[model samples]
Each structure stands twice: as structure tokens, then as C-alpha cells.
Target: MISPRPSLAKRAFDVAASASALLVLSPVLLLAALAIRLESSGPVFYASWRVGAGYRRFRLFKFRTMYPDADQRLKDLAHLNQYAAEADAPEASGEGCAACAALEEGATCSPVLVGDGGEVICEAEHRRRQNAGPAFFKLQDDPRITRVGRFLRNTSIDELPQLVNILLGDMSLVGNRPLPLYEAEQLTADGDGARWMAPAGLTGLWQVTQRGTGEVSPEERIALDNTYAESHGLGFDLRLIAKTVPALFQSENV
Candidate 1:
């Protein structure tokens, strides 16, 4: 278990700060949601269950970035992305909460739009491609992004709904970033599996350190996250949050 977590004052600060952020950012969020629905047919908000504090699971909200059935397609490709972590760490896989993990390979669906009156858009599970022939794994630059999607992601506007997670107490303003179930399990064998000890956050130490850095191996990423957890405190949280400001302007791979 994590030796100890942030102090009550810090935790309270996170709650108050996130709440205030949500209130002030509400207009921006609503506008973004309207843009998403205009260009796509999916819901204004895309909610996925992500690993959270205390190793718990919580639905994370994001502006939809892919085709609606992306979940099913992911399901079909499960073996590869699942065991993709490594060959020997463990021989088991957990069923993803999203249907993407269940869709079979070779299945193809015509491009569909998410909104009624916007740009042409199609949400696909496999649109991770750039110039065809299998898509690239990306922290950013997904080929499937719509014109508006591109703008939203680059500006980090797509993450606005997460303010709800903070309000619900399912997330924090600063902490380790959350992981997909598959990524969580894969990192387990990579030196204590940093995910096991870290609470999912909207921002964290890794976010700041990794800014302007090149492709990071999973090992290095885990190390940064663990270090944050090891020394977390009220002052440290404030420091990291402050650092994240300038880091936000830096172009990160994600």
C-alpha cells in the first residue's frame, strides 16, 4: 500500500480547487460539448471506467474522440493489446469495461457521424492509423480525429468533463495519471507496477517532467509516478500543480 497520502488540508484543497475550476470552466466545457455533438453522433460525453484512487474503478468523462463502436473493435484486438505488455509477466487478462475489447478482427464498419449538423465524422475503433496499414500507438496525433477534434485535443479542451470526476471525489486535481486496465496490468511487472500504488489524477509529476521529453519507456514513466507518490504532501502537490502550468504550453507527445 502507499505509505501515506496527502494530508487532510491538501485533500480538502483539491476538492475546493477542482470545484472552483469546474464552475469557472463550465462555459468553455459546454461550448466544447456542443461542438462535439454537432460533428458526431455519439453522446456529448464519453464515459469510460478507469482505475482510480485506492485501486478503485470510476467512470472517467472525456469529449468523444473516436467512432461510437470503437469499444467493440478494441475487444476483438484484446489478445495483442492485452499481452502486448509482455509475454511472461502473467497469463491472464481482464475484460475491458468498454465493448471495444470484444469486437472481432476483420470487422469493418462504414464511417458514421456523431453529430447531426457539423463536419463529416466517423468514430472507429481502429482509426489509430496515419497513412493506412495498422495505426500507430499514440499519446497524441490520432489519425481518426475530426477537424474540431484536432483543435480540442491540442488545446487540452477535450478533458473538460473530468471536472465532474473531481467533484464526485473519484479523482484528484494532482496525482498519478490513471491507466487503462491493460496498461495497469502490463506495468505490474515493470518494477512493482507503479499503478498499484498511485491514485489516478488529471495531472501529476510525470506530466510536468515528461513535457518536451521524447518517447518514454513504460519503465521510466512508472518511475516518475512512483516518485510522486512516495513524497506526496500538500506543499508538493501545490508545487507540481504550479509546474504543470508551463508544462501545459509545451508540446507533449500526448
Candidate 2:
């Protein structure tokens, strides 16, 4: 099925806003780039694959916020992940796996891995889940973050480069936030993958509402994204942009 395109006005706005921001923030962006270089030994910019609107893959740009070997160190730091405890929780039997179970009543629960004959789970499937990270992963005191990284994260200066994404028509200024490849894989497994229909953006309903307070659950975040997908328009987008400024100042945003 062909994916629906974002509205003409929305696309136009994205181009205009992103270009204006990049031009206006040129100095700040330069300073951030320099700081990242001075404090780190890797490339100043960090680009990672992300799933954008309609499940399209695109490279997301950000100021490098972790040590050069952060990806290599992920496995070692898995235990420190805020989502580790929850991901490792005992598999939910009755209600927890209800959605998956409803589709196939006698199917072994994916999380539990047990079956009628003590059958082993598929190795590929198991590894996929393991590598998919979590529904949400945020560390309040992540050790991988550099000194300059912490400041960039706190001030959200690191995200300025995403304006380039917006200008490139890969993202919008306000819409549902895009997901990393792993996170996108997980979201696609959920029945509510329709949330991916919305244009990916730097600021969105969840970011404006949660503002890194970290109280929002994974399900809730997806729901918020779906809501925005269903209801968002130019006016709503403007309102979200207005709210974004204050949300950026929230202490937890760091």
C-alpha cells in the first residue's frame, strides 16, 4: 500500500522553519560542534539510522553526546539500562501477553519461551528481541555521556542538527518523533504501528507533554504519538511548537 504523504502546507512549513532555524542558530551550532570536538575523539556529529514516516529509513543527525566507543560499550552497560529491570521481568502470562495470545491461543508466549513439550524458542527471534533494546531507554546518569555531552543534552543543543533533517524533508518541525531502528522494530511488532503514519519530527506531543520527566510509560508514549497522528494539523503543530520552548527548560530534559 502506498503511504499517504504529509500535507503540502506542512511540508512547506518544515522547509521554511528548518532553514530559518539553521541559519539563525548557525553560531550556536558551530560552538556546539567545536565543544563536541574538544571533548571527544570521534566525529563531532553522530548520525544514526532512524525510522521516519511510513517506516522509511533515514539517517538522523545529532551532536555526538557519548564517548567515541559508545555503541561498542552498549552491551557492557546493558545492566545499567533503566529499562533492563523491566525488560527482564518475569513474562506476563494471562493479561500481559493478551494481544499476542489472542491471535493464537495455544502459541507459546514469546517472552516466556516455554511450550507444551519444552520446545526451544527460535534463536533468531530471541536475538532480535535482545538487540531491539527496550520500548524506552533513558539513563538519568549514563556513564557513557561525556562532560560536554551532558551539557548539550541538558540544553538540547545537540538536536540542532536535526534541522537539517527537517530541511531535507525527512522530518518535520512538529509531529510524532521518529524511532531508532531497534525501537522501530519493536513498535512495528505492536498492533498500534499506525502511529508511524505521522511525519517524524524533532518536537511532538509526547516530548512536549513528558519533557523527559520519564514518568510516561512506553504504551502511553505510543498512544500519544497515535493521537497526534490522528489529530495533528497546522494549528495544532503551531501550538506544540509554542509549548516546546518551555518544555525544553524542564530539569528532567537533561
Leading candidate by lDDT: 2
lDDT of 1 by residue, 1-254 (tens): 46334567866987899889888988998889888888888887788877765567778998886667767666455445322333222223432112334456533244444434553333332222121121113424444567777777767787777877877777777888776665554455445455446556788887788876755555566678778777776788888888877876766635
Model 2 weakest lDDT span, ten residues long = 90-99
CA shift of 20, model 2, Å:
0.9
TM-score for each predicted model, relative to the true structure: 0.71, 0.82
Note the Cα lDDT for every prediction shown.
Answer: 0.64, 0.78
RMSD of 1: 14.7
lDDT of 2: 0.78
